[model samples]
Target: MQLRIKPYNKNAFPLKALLIKGDSVRHWVSEIHALGLSLSEVDAYPVPGSSANTVFGCFVLLHSNKKLSDLRMHEQFQSVRDLLFIPSFSTLFPAMSEQELRKLFSSSKYFIHPETGLVELPEPIDWSELLIVPVEKCREIEKPQDAVFIPRNVDRFQIKAMPPEDALQEMEDQVFPKKKEFEDKPLNLFEKGKLLFYKLLFTGKEGKQGMFDGSDIKMPAWLSKLWPGFGGTWFDKMQEDFADLEERNKRKVDKLMEMLENDPEEALRYAIPIDPEGRGRGQIGNAALDFFTRRSNFSLFGTDGRSGSGYAVDLGDAMYDLQRQYIKTAEELKRKGDYEKAAFVYMKLLKNYVKAAETLEEGHKYNEAASIYLKHANNKTKAAQCYEKGNMTMEAIELYKELEANEKVGDLYLTINHRKEANIYFEKVATAHIDCARFLKASIVYRSKMNDPEAAQSVLLKGWRAHRDGNNCLRCYFDNIADTKELGREINAIYKNDVSEANVDNFLDVIRHEYKKKNELAENIREIAYEIIAARSQSDPSIVVTLKNFNENDKELLKDAVRFKLNNKGK
Candidate 1:
């Protein structure tokens, strides 16, 4: 019975399998089919017990115990020689375990999936291992028309891997051979003097021979022969060159000083050059730098005044130019994403703390900005602002308190809904602003945020004490009171302990007006009014007769006046 085998396509499985040893070829073929692997027709064949010997175009199964050497001599096997070979382990080496077989073939490359019973060729067969049989005795074999032979180069394959460092050293040894080492000997005094003299001359303006046509100077040919050695003629020439350079530099220095007096800003343009690499142009460069430093009053290299030179010049213009240059350099550094270096230049060199802080803030470096503002700029308010902007509320509040900005402290506390802390700051604000009559703002904060009416009332009362018009302030307090009953009780308590007649009269009028407006009940008003009049009668004795005469026509008023006089008769 022929099994219904699926048609083969290279896209489904591009790899081909070559199976050897027919002893278990039937079982191996079944396993390969179960793995859904496509096999080349040239390499695959069906065994007797294999399911339905229907052959696909790719898989080739060889059912024979043929050695690789014997198979390579066959024309059919030659076409699929390059394809992957899978030989049954048991058939190839009887009584051998999988581990033993793998160890025996360790030098070769192969793949094995034990779970799927899948295997591939460990290595290509060695053609030289084949037997050399005579053509007359050998069986005739037909080769495929499209078969292509590929020759392997043994020398191209490396058996062992080389480490990178070892390979590099090997290449270096081949390219650069070792050479003898030479030691340097020190020069004598005359040779050293000649070297210094030549260096000075070469680096001087006169050394730039190319700059002037027909005015070039050259060392004598005999000097080259003697080279590093110095003699009387070389020494005289060196001294003459030194003297000429000195005179020229002195003239330049005089001109620079004149510019410093007339056009100081322009003098900055002609200031000494700073060679960052320290490649000095002999004595002139050093002398020019010293002159500029002294003129600018820079104490970095120590002033010449203490040395009795007293060559200090006005540094105002130079200092200004340096500050501007530093600011420009810092800005450029910031633009180049070098924030740390930029901050250092701004803080250490320029000392422009405000600009540094502003730059930090612009860069989203809030914590650093706050620190600079606090420590360097000494602006606590701005520091607190920075902290608050950065969502660092606790830090901001602490700074605000340190600055005595109580209102800001209270506002911050209130913003975070820390009512208890808000109330504490509000009370502080109320106390601080009491004399200024600004305590009411704190009272508003206390009432709205803390919901403490009594605290608010207490703050308002303290403010009213410091107010010039106590009567108007007291009236205003009553008008704005949250609870009218609470205000009435507070007023009753104040009036009961009163001793001054003028204050008593003011309280009486307020009570009367409040009673008329129904802000205070009739009974409480009457009691406070009696307390005020009795207190006033002690200072002015005619108060009793004036009240009796004024209320003579009103029965209730007359009765109340007599009751008041009788009640205060003991005092």
Candidate 2:
């Protein structure tokens, strides 16, 4: 007899099942009875003969308000040969929009048949494929509640439940079964030596062994072999030894801390080992230094002098000591001909400018010394001196100019026989000083070294205009000239076109004064004097009265002047 089965509807029942199509329906009924679930507990539907051609059978556990993809399967049920499972759907489509649900059903590879109102796959699926609708597509369906499902207790029907003791035995057999007993292996020579070394290093009483624990202690393979077994006793002994050494170090640090409360400097001395031998046993010293240097609070000795706890030493004091040590180390490096290293320590660590510069200078490192002096010490003069000593003449000149030491700058140029450079600096000074002496020096340099008399004359001209006493400058110009006749001719040419009578008068006065100082011949002086008067008479007719007034002093001046005037007479 053939039984007609309708499509399963998830909304009509909480649980549903798909009947496996077989040769006889009685076989399936017996199998279901053999399992714990009864036929009434599940809503089973018969698979048509065409859909049951394969061994795989699909059973979908659906929820009214959830998607099949949302349900989580137990690990054991994740894959099965005959049972093709689909999870509940509420997690996939909880509160999904209506438009999204319509779009999902329209485009999904798995969809509910319109006629049957039942979900269907694209084709018949194998159980081993673990086929289900795609999670992403399922998430588009609209649902009101989260996806959930009651897991079936398949283990009760699939296999016999073992007793508690039998389960424990089975786990033990898989993980840690007993092994056959064997005799102990003998130790090799290297292993024996290692064991012996460890025993000797760790097994001794606290004060009995030498204080080599903190040093480069290692097990050597060449040591004599004297041990029997590698056991736990050695580790215990080593731990005890470490504890005792730690306690000793703690006591020493505490003692140093106490002394720091009273005499910090004395405590600092103990904190840094002085003797070479004491350096090897500096564990306590290092600890004490660290303890004081840190920011945490430390307890004092008793309540007599201090009641509250504070730092054993302030940061300032600690840094001061550290700086002193650094300076000492730098000095030692300097003494040992390690000047570069010493300078680094002085500059970077100690920040001692004087010492750093001195050390650099001692090593003939003048460039670095100049930099340190100029930048750190703010001593431009010293920096220039260093540059000069190093033969960095241009650098020294620049530095001297920065200091505005124009005289020193000129002197420096002169020392190097750089007369042109000297003249440059002298010109700057002359411009600043506006003195005849400075201009004279510049002119001398221009004449002697540069061999440019035109430049020298220009300098003199500038000096004459700059200085208040032009007469001194005029005398300097006269002294610079080689011939008195040429000097007279030059002076006549200079005053020939003088529009100002005062300027001509000043020129005459300068010539007269210069002549008086040298006691030059009267005729020579009269020649220059008459040339100026004759030129002045042409420009201004009033010079005759001045000439007459000048003739009153000497009768030779009048005769010579009359003859000079008559020689220049024209039609």
Candidate 3:
């Protein structure tokens, strides 16, 4: 009837089901595991695959009966709501589905098994550190409609159901019954409304807490699918939590606000955790930091933008941290379609980037900036806003291009793929780039990435349009240029038409003539020397040529240092 299932580390959580001799449990365990839960051992009975016909059932993990988190998670076990979790399954067993087991191979929460569920797998444990880190959510996920190989959230990818609106509504409807079994309804309508409201928001159907409450409630997928506690989601209790955190933080902020008048040192001294509503990563605190910095600056110096010793200066660490967080959060927000906030946060990063770019080169400073931009691209709508702030956006995109971070840059492009604005800026940047390989790559991307060859060619043409259409000044400097003859004719035509810059052909002709003369001088040295002597002074470079010719008859000139031999080597 009750079970306790807890593991100190990632060890197996044994399963033991207390049932009659004919309880028919094996098929049941297999089904639950198939749905994605971990299973280890079972008590006295054989329940691995008991049923031949049945497809699914719960894996039974027993730990000295049942703990509250476990019991509350099940169908009708409500008695142990107050018990603390302990890991002794002497009379009970640990139960999990095959899917869960495969995803989390070891019964440990630290490493998730591949076939398991969707929570992002956390990094490995550091032996040097004692604390355990939670797994990160996987960026790679797919919905039913998405191509099997492609990640979800493309233009064609539909949204996955997370607690479909219907579930929330159905639970809501139950609160206001036509006629309740109880005689007393409420002392006041407002009170009744308040009670119903709290119930609807905090608990799911059958009084299930919609969140983790330090309890071991292994929520079934059926229920969790309805109340998704995934990344960046706002649950029913979020507002209430925001309210309470806000109240405590409010006084600190007010003090911080006042501190803005005189001491920013004191303002930052207020410490992190300033805003409760601010999830660990966000721009909320940056706004607070900006407020503090501006107030301090204004109070110290006149509003004319002059600084004095009296001005309160913040190290601006808070701003930096908040931006870093926002850089991460903004991307997440975009993915979730909280576009307004995501866009606003991205704008915040752009402003910071401007400030950062002032102190460092755009290329180097963009390293950090681009990371934030990456998350921005995870959601296209947010990227559209950032894309407009020319400098920051261009800098961000340049870094993305250099890295060839396709998953990111490609997706960002998807957002702006159809926009004229996107086309214009991309063309400008593509044209500025010297690598034709970049053009070729973009060409390849058209076919492979978004599956649009027209887009690829358009991108390539923009990149190579100027280079391919004309001979380069550098290339014309070389005599080996193949189009010299044609180019010269073009030059003559241009000259006849009174052109400003010389035509490519004329440049090539000059280069070619120089090469021709050099070749003749090398082959007909005597003639060149004769001509030189006839036209020039008593002794010139021609004299040297004559000496070299005479040297052929001197054996000494051929000796060691010379090609001619000495008297002993006279040949």
Q: Rate the local accuracy (lDDT) of all candidates.
A: 0.50, 0.49, 0.35
Clash counts per candidate, in order, are: 13, 10, 53
In the range 315-395, model 1's lDDT, one tens digit per residue, is 334445545555565576677765544554455445557876787677765666777776667888887887787777777
| 2 against 3, candidate with superior TM-score | 2
Q: Which stretches of candidate 2 lie over 4 Å from their true place?
A: 1-287, 291-342, 370-388, 392-445, 462-469, 491-509, 516-523, 526-571
Q: Judged by TM-score relative to the true structure, which candidate is superior, 1 or 2?
A: 1
- 408-466: candidate 2 lDDT, tens digit per residue: 78877776677777877666665664444466666665666456788777777666655
Root mean square deviation (Cα) for candidate 2: 38.9
| Worst window of 10 by summed lDDT in candidate 3 | 295-304
Candidate 2: residue pairs that collide: 66-89, 66-90, 67-88, 67-89, 67-90, 68-87, 68-88, 68-89, 90-147, 91-147
Query: Tens digit of lDDT per residue, candidate 3, span 1-571?
Result: 3333333343233222221122344544444344343333322222222346532223233334333333323332111111111223321145545564445434332211112321221232232243344888879665666555854555532222212234223322442112212122212434334434543444543334322242322334544687676423343344454333323323343444454335423332222321223332223321111222222111100122222323222323444545354456545545565443333333332333232222212323222222333442343322223332333444335446555543445445555444444444444444434354355544444445545555654554444334342233223222222354553443344334422233323323333343344442233333433343333323222222333442355655334323222222422
- Number of clashes found in candidate 2: 10
Candidate with more favorable, higher lDDT: 1 or 3? 1
TM-score leader: 1
